[model samples]
Structures are given as C-alpha cells and as structure tokens.
Target chain A: DAGVTQSPTHLIKTRGQQVTLRCSPKSGHDTVSWYQQALGQGPQFIFQYYEEEERQRGNFPDRFSGHQFPNYSSELNVNALLLGDSALYLCASSSGGRREGHLNTEAFFGQGTRLTVV
Target chain B: QKEVEQDPGPLSVPEGAIVSLNCTYSNSAFQYFMWYRQYSRKGPELLMYTYSSGNKEDGRFTAQVDKSSKYISLFIRDSQPSDSATYLCAKKRNDYKLSFGAGTTVTVRA
Candidate 1:
C-alpha cells in the first residue's frame, strides 16, 4: 500500500506571493492534516480536513487555508507569504476523523514539501 | 509554558549503547503520548506510542509514561548508526491534533 504522498518536494516563493502545496493521503485513510516544521523545531499542527471540510484548526491565521477533495487529496494554500513562512510542510493521514475514538489512530506522514520564502 | 517541553540535544553516543530521551508536558488532559524519529530533510516517522502511565516495549524501543509526573520517555537499546535521528515527543488529548516538543537530535557513532 502506498503511504502518504506530497508534491513539489521543494518550492521557493517570494514575499507577498502565494503558494499551494499538495498532498495525497494513504490508501484506506479518510482524514488529512497539515503541519509546519520550522528549523530546529518539531512540527506544529496547522489544520485538519475531513469530509471535504475543515474540521479542526490550530493557531495559524486566516492567510493559511486548505481544501480536501472527494478523492481524499488535499491542497494547502498560503497567501501573502512572509519570510517566516519558510519551513517544511508536512501532510499526515489517519484512518478516521476527530469524532472517532482516539485509540489506534496512528497518523502516517509524507516526506513533506520544503517551502522557502525569499 | 509550552504544552510539551523537550530538550533539544545533539546527544552523541557510541554504538550499542542505550539512548534515552525524555519530555515533560504541563497538561493532564494529554492521555496519548508518542515518539517520532525524523531524518534530515524527511518527515517524522512514528516510533512508539503509549496511552497509560506505564511502559510499553516494542523491539529495541521502550516508551515509558508517568501521568502523575506528567513525564514521558523513550529508550532505544543497542542503538545503531541508523538510529541516529531527531527524536520528537508528542502528546494528544481528545482532539486529533498533536502538540509536539522541540525535537532532540541524537547521533550514534560507530
């Protein structure tokens, strides 16, 4: 079975510009969540998508948004990117949504897209 | 204070030695604890997970959780060069989101 997959392994964007990162969840998984890992830091949750709608979100501002398609693929869009936006964008997929019980809800991650804002 | 706090250690150890990593959390609502290992320029891979206040062993990895003390630990036995990676301690509550600590970078020298 194929694991989680992300597109454009590396990307460079300019300040005030916009960028979109893509993710395809693992087979048999229904939920997709996005995370940002800054240099020398662990990943911070961005948001989670389920049933083609955003179900949970973290501390990120409105500039960061995402969409989940019927096929379970997801796209993360960052508008008016800032220099601090440079980080590793990771996509993780799990079996069920937040409404489901937490037990055995292991999330598998993709290699992540490296986003650099110049 | 951060929800989860871990030492960012560039800890170096000889091969076949035991590698210990620890993290502390301030939230008692965090019932699920996990350890993830990430290589350079790669996403984190889950290594071990535990829910209760005790120990769970899997192969060379043993994860220990102390709910009373709000502490969690991961131990790698007979570590190899391939075991060198950044170790992340993560905690989760009823929500699906995870709160992670600053990862600890470990190097196992051959």
Candidate 2:
C-alpha cells in the first residue's frame, strides 16, 4: 500500500501570494494532519482533520487553512504568504482519530513540499 | 521557555557508534512521547512512540520516557551512515496536541 503522497516536491511563491499544497493519505487511513518545519527545527503541528472536519489546530494564524476531502485526501492553503512561511509543509496520516489504545497512532509523513516565499 | 527543549546537535560520530538523543519538556500533562527521524529536506517519519514513563524497544532503536522528570530519550544502536538524519522528540498532551523540540542532526561517517 502506498504511504502518504504530497504534490509538487518544491514550490516558490512571492510575498502576499497564496499557495496550496495537497496530500493523499495512506491506504485504509482516514485522518489527515499538516505540519510546518522551519530550517533547523522540528515539524510544528498546524492542524488535524478527521471525518472531514478539523478536530485540532495549532497556533498558526488565520492565513493558514485546510480542507479534507471525502477520500481523506487533504489540502493546506496559506494566503498572503510571508517570508516566515518559507518552510517545508508536511502532510501526515493515521488510522482513525484520537482514542484509547490507538495502534501507535503513528503518523506516516510524506516527503514534504518545500515552500519558498520570496 | 519552549514547552519542549532539545539540543540541536550537528553531532558527528563514526559508523558503528551508538547514538543517544534526548529532549525535556516543561509540561506535566504530556502523556505520550514520540521520536521522529527526518532526512535532509524530507518530512519526519515516526521512529518511536511510547506512553507514560517506561521503555519501549524496537530492533536497534529504543525509546525511553521518564515522566517523573519530564524527559525522554531515543537511543540508536550500531549507528550507520544510513542512519544520518535529524531526530526530533515530540510530546502529545491534551487533544492529541503535539509539541516538538528543535531536532538534533546526526551525521554518521563511515
């Protein structure tokens, strides 16, 4: 079975522009999550989508929004991108949402898209 | 202070050496601990996950958690050049919120 897949291995956008990154979950998985990793830093949680609804969110601003499709695929949209938004946008997937005894709930991540905002 | 603190090491070690990575968190509510490995320019892949204070081993990798001290560690045995990557330590608290530390980069040279 294929693991999580992300589109456009690399992307470049100018300041104030908008960019959309996509991700397809692993086979049999239904939850999708997004993260952002800055240079020399760990991936920071952006938000998580389950049942096509956002169940959790991080401290990101309103400019960062996302949608989860019925197929469990996801898209992260960032509007009015700033230089600070230049980072690797990572997409991860897990089977089911948070609950007891979740088998590792290990999120399989894709080879993130490197977003460069100039 | 950051909720989670980790040494951002560009640590270089010869092949066959054992590697130890660690992170500390200030929150006591953290119940789940995890470690992720990320190659250059790649997203992180989950390496190990453990709940509460204890030890969990998988092959050459071992994850240790000391909830009493709010510290966690990831140990790599028989480190190889292919093991070279940045290791991140993360904690999941309420609502499955994940807080990550600045990862430590390891370079295993043959």
DockQ of each: 0.71, 0.61
Error of 1 at B102 (Å): 0.7
The list of candidate 1 runs beyond 4 A from truth reads: none
For residues B1-110, what per-residue lDDT tens digits would candidate 1 score against the true structure? Answer: 99999987889999999999999998787468999999999999998888899999999999999988898999999999999999999998888788999999999999
Judged by DockQ, which candidate is best?
1
Q: TM-score (chain B) for model 2?
A: 0.95
Q: In every candidate, what fraction of the native interface contacts is reproduced?
A: 0.60, 0.63
- Separately for all candidates shown, the number of backbone clashes (residues 3 or more apart, or on different chains) is 0, 0
User: Candidate 2 has what TM-score?
Assistant: 0.95
lDDT of 2 by residue, B4-98 (tens): 99977878999999999989999686367889998887778888888867889999999998887888999899999999999999887756557
DockQ of predicted model 1? 0.71
The chain A TM-scores for the candidates, taken one by one, are 0.95, 0.95
Clashing pairs in model 1?
none
